[model samples]
Target: MKQILKTILLPLFLITALSLNNCATIFSGTSQDVEINAKPQGTTIIILGGTIGKIIRYGAKIQSFIDIFSEYLDEEDKKVLERYSFESLITAVILEVRGVVPVERSMSQEVAKVLAKIPRSYKVKVLNTFGMEEFALAPVKTELKTSGGYAVIGYMSGKKIVVKEINTRLNWTILWNVLNGFILLPIDVLTGAYKKLTPLELDMELNEPGEKLSDYQAQGPNQKILILVN
Candidate 1:
């Protein structure tokens, strides 16, 4: 019974930890948005970033399966498994999932069509510029939008993008970490807590240190620049 409890509780605890957006948001620096105001308001914005939460979840599932058969494994096999840890798995998965996801596609292919072309360079800019903030340390959600909706806004800096805040609502329960089936589902619906979307009014500056204006212009004219990220 004790071994069974350990098996069930360990995964449940990890899952619960995975669902905590506050903790994730605090660490995941990927929650910011970029906004640009050019003569043309609806120009296309392309963002390149990806999240790894799903991959991590999948890995945990695999590990759980392995744990189920652990008792039958030889000492050498057990040693091999012991060499790997959950935290390491999560880290590896995050690195693998981090990449580009186009947020908005270009509408027109004309010579003078409005386009805020965010080359891979600017993405690096934002990540490097704002990475030091405490909130940025949160685990990045692979999904573009969280349970609570996000918004874009203006700032004091000339051309800035920021992740103002993250508000997430979960059908949370203390037992969700342990129980399943009919019991857990109903409890979630009945006792779930709701969170209202709080406005994220962060003023993120895009100016990378030691870089001049020439660096910011990866593509397009000056007046037609805006940064819209997911």
Candidate 2:
């Protein structure tokens, strides 16, 4: 009788725990992290989101017009839209609507001139390699600090409290449920691990402070900026 009770009761507990774990991943998710290090004391550092955010907003605005047209679209129009992946189209529109705008900061002409005279190096870390499609549309929060006279350090990145998991596969955690016992329930819940983000890293070095940002070539990720100074 005890064995029967264990068999029935244990799987239910595991299922319940797993459901909560999945829900947490879907909702809370993980925050983006960027580590910054810059040189020269009192060197001004500026971090801003790039054109990707702007493009998304423009796309969403355009999609809104498409939605209006859809109301009048005939069967042929429906077929045309059907030719495209529904998930892809919707995700594109959603990302744009929720995309983060770059922060705007300008230097006074006199201050800019003074900094231009000082020679220094620059680094920008673009944390994710794939793309900005996954980030939630929101403003990035910036924090600034001094790291010795040679460098300034801080964290800058947008938050996506809720995110959709894409191109993901089942993992050992989910498979562990096959064991079907109370013993594994706690282990699964405590580990509850899942892949949530694919972030790229961008490292840039400016030979001198006098050089313009456009002069440097950077690789990895679009729309997201890990480090920038202007």
Query: Candidates' TM-scores?
Result: 0.22, 0.25
Off by over 4 Å in 1: 23-46, 50-159, 163-230
Error of 2 at 12 (Å): 7.0
Model 2, 113-216: lDDT tens digits are 32233222210112121122223112223322111001111111221111111112223454365455343322235555332222313232222332212111
Error (Å) of candidate 2 at residue 29 is 17
Q: What is the lDDT of residue 222 in candidate 1?
A: 16
Which lDDT tens digits does candidate 1 get at residues 89-193?
222212222331121211112200111222335434433442211112222222334323232211111232221222233324532633452211111335432
lDDT comparing candidate 1 with the true structure: 0.27
